[model samples]
Target: MESLEQKSSIARFLDNVFKLSENNTTVKTEILAGVTTFMTMAYILVVNANILGEAGMDKPAVFVATALSAFVGSLVMGLVANYPIACAPGMGLNAFFTYTVVIQMNHTWQFALCAVFIEGIIFILLTLTNVREAIIDCIPPLLKHAVTAGIGLFIAFIGMINTGLVKVGGAAVTLGSMRDPLVLLTVVGLIIAAILMSKNVKGAFLLAMIITSALGMVSGLITIPKGIISAVPSIEPVFMKAFSVSTSEIFSFDMVVVVFTFLFVNLFDTVGCLVGVASKGNLLNADGTLPRAKQALLADAIGTTAGAVLGVSTVSSYVESSAGISQGGRTGLTATTTGILFLASLFFAPIFTAIPAQATGPILILVGVLMASSVLQLNFSDPTDAIPAFLTFVMMPLSYSIANGIMFGMISYTILKLVTGQKEKVNKALIIISILFVCKFIFL
Candidate 1:
């Protein structure tokens, strides 16, 4: 049969390069894992466009841009990095680009894209010089664990806000009206997702999203799309706008703040995700480091710049890729497959975008549940590590900013180390970063 013959050649090549047997994964298993990963993170296409659209970018253009970025990024990750990590426009970074830069700061989206482009360039330079590895090693292990947990809270917070399960008051956030059917629908979806995830059902998160969205449609809560596919939108609207920003913007202090925040959040989040998912896939080396780490960093940097040029936000490795990693994907073929699917997704824009945010909300909450497990790595018995880590855990979601949490945690950690007579534990790189964060607050 055609299928059998195709699988034979593909399987042999994958087995030779990725050591399919050595990793206890086959071409078939890797393909399945890729699909699993794409299903979990598919919301990015719709969600990213909507988010960036708020900044006045064309929705359809951003939609196409988002998918293309993911396709190219994941392809690079597979071919160059040779890992199972999938890259896409990041969640928190997009919020920052939209709310912080374009809205609050009143900068053009073009300016924000310029900042991202510059940040990606810096990442590339750092990766080439091997500075990224040095900086990664400089971060305290406990702080890295805290970053994972903090991101969990951040994800859940985004989920709740999206579904109207939580509302922002003047001083604090309060619960939305549960009497409303929309709120109730969100609650039901979360419950379904939790139940499926607890049962270890494959594609539990994706299944929950599908079922919830279908229910929403039936109840008239979501609009049913008239068709599954749509004509590909022109990139001129977003692409032209992104490149219109002047290079002089790079010297602006506001741009510095935006770019630094992008770099900061992207760096730690990628580190935390890689550590967690690499370990799960058994893709780590004997020294507990990811192989071809520099190449991985370079691919991610390339993705960010390419994505911005293509009219999206910063690109980073997704923690949601862990869904596939846990599904026995230990090779680059998994990422390659995911990339191909992303390319195919360009044709099914209507179907992907028709998904309501409320449906995606539950998946974020469920994924947060998965990420929160990193807290188990905390050393609470030790005060120095515990105090800073705990602060990061609380402040990330509370402050609604990952960079804020990282900033405060690092400052507290350094101070606590000094006061507690553990100054030797403080590294030069961290001290420099703490100082820079302080400078950003003070000067900017």
Candidate 2:
């Protein structure tokens, strides 16, 4: 009886903190959602470490940095913004960090880290000034809806690529072989998730992942981890390396270009994710802007900055949070749960890494299906709206870039509005943004 009272008291505390009732969610649902989100995006720890390792950094140190950055970012996001979004060193930006900044530019990895730090500071200032938030608000309602669907296609494509369900063919792309166990298991996982979803099962995404992982283990598809707990790696090698750059390197033109590229890509990636996920989660306000937009934007800004200090690439909101949101995560408690898990993963790396892409891929695909439904809310009668929205969603998968898709949509929207003599419909922020996009292509 005493234990039951303690449990009840804890439940009431959580309800008060997260406003569980107001969001139409419960403590159990939020926890499941957080776990689901973490499961889907956990691959980032290995991926980021490997990518940055190519730039001549310490692999073990980078791994520790990745986990710490994710923990810090997600914790701040949950406590400050009260949003369900999780943060990690983003995928594309890490590639650019190693390939473009470190390898091609002949800059030291430390220089690249410095650039990321600068870009993150700029992001914080931009967020404080509401520059980033205004850009989101200025986006046409149709385009906002398209962003949701676009990210849906983007992440689904990501899932397909991750699971070996899709491959590069002679031309653009092709399907994976049916004989491959990875591909076969992914298909079965998708079917299982679909059926669970159809039956309205709570925690369907999490359940699907567990079931698929179990199947893989039984079939000798995924290797079982040797053990669960490992010693936490020391981060001293990478920590604060971003501040080691020489003054000349910091002031160089290369730094400018690198910082600009990081800034540009991360800005849109974070914005698109926030807008898309918020839209899907019904967190957007009546005016199509997100409530607590400043706090939400600050979360990513802080993540990126802290990630740089921790010796990693820019950290931003992960679109995989949609998996949690789909599982009825409506408040910051979900993000807090994910944050705590990231912290715990530092010691349990092997166990977390043991979960393969085959298990998570289908969950991302299912999330794509949920987000893509926003397309139905769009008005297709006007060419001015329909054409841009079409490009926004279609180009995301084709170009393999959320930022590129948004760029095309914005530029075309501006052109169509001007050409159609509907200039009144375009706001000042939209025109400035369109011009900036053009400038990015020509200048960057």
Candidate 3:
């Protein structure tokens, strides 16, 4: 009788708070959805940690930070916004942070963290002032789609180079030796992943990575780590170093450009995913807006800030949450469940940190395939728009800089619009951004 009463009380609380039944969902359903979502996104831990590890950050520390950031973001979304969306350190942004900021720009990880932190705070202000909506509305759709597709190619190209599937020569990047065992294994993994994805396999990326890593291990390619389970690494390596070390750099033009890229990517990605998953769960209003849009945006902003504090890249809403919503998760309970699972992941940092980079390289490549699909949504009938979009797609991989792609795309876009008699489409916001892009080239 007592157990029955306890269950009744819990049910009443959830229904009252999240309106679970109104959404045609139950606690068990929400839990299942959460688990499904987590399984699909579990690759982020290894991928984020490994990517940031290349920036000279501690891998285990990054693993814990990634999990904790996801936990905080998802929990806040569940409780504060009553949404089923899950959040985590983003993919392309992390790659940009590590590869472009740290490697190409020669900035320390600390400086990169400072940029992310400032970007988060700016996002919070934007949400509060409702400036976010205005800014988003000002950007032309052609440029936005270009940015997404360009980043996709950028991500895939990075993975290819990292895995030695593509190599650089004096003249250009050339095909690597097909005889290399690791390269061959990555190709096999990519094919398997493509097949699984085509068949609608859940957690295709994570599963493919595991199978690939296991094969590498058997082939004497992947070396086993020193240990499987160990103490959770400390965040000291990342925590406050950025704030102190980046004072001078943070005010420079170069730092501003980096912060702007992080801001633009996180803002667009979160807004798009929030609306998408919300629509999937029927959590949006009649007018195509998330019911608690501001609250959800706040939760996302807080997640990124918290991530910076804990020492990781910018966190954003994961579109993979759509998988959860499709599983009948329609309330905050699902987000809570995902949050708990991410917190539990903190203990398995050692194992996650040990996943081979070659294994993760395949996941990045596959994700690029997913992201590049967004280009199909853009209209190519207008050359004025198509030319800029083309530039965005080509330059992202060729220049090896997301910031540069957007920068050049904007300049070309604005110039073409003016010369092609589409001057009305060029707004002041775009003009300002174009000027900044020009300054990035001339001054920074």
What range of 10 consecutive residues in model 1 has the weakest lDDT sum? 272-281
TM-score of decoy 3: 0.70
Relative to the true structure, candidate 1 reaches a TM of 0.87
Error of 3 at 320 (Å): 8.5
Q: What is the C-alpha lDDT of each candidate?
A: 0.81, 0.93, 0.78
Candidate 1, position 141, lDDT: 66
**Candidate rank order under lDDT:** 2, 1, 3
Over the stretch 344-408, how does candidate 3's per-residue lDDT look in tens digits?
Answer: 77775555545665776666677667667768856789888888888876787897655566667
Query: Which prediction has more favorable TM-score, 1 or 2?
Result: 2
State how far residue 275 of model 2 sits from its true place (Å). Answer: 0.6
lDDT of 2 by residue, 269-339 (tens): 88889999999999999989888889999999999999999999999999999999999999999999999
Give residue 274's lDDT in candidate 1 (0 to 100). 66
Each prediction's TM-score against the native?
0.87, 0.98, 0.70
Residue 361 CA displacement from its true place in model 2, Å: 0.4
Q: Which candidate is the best by TM-score?
A: 2
Tell me the deviation in Å of residue 21 in model 2. Answer: 1.9
Q: Report the lDDT tens digits of candidate 1 across residue range 209-254.
A: 7898899999998889898887887888888466687767768878
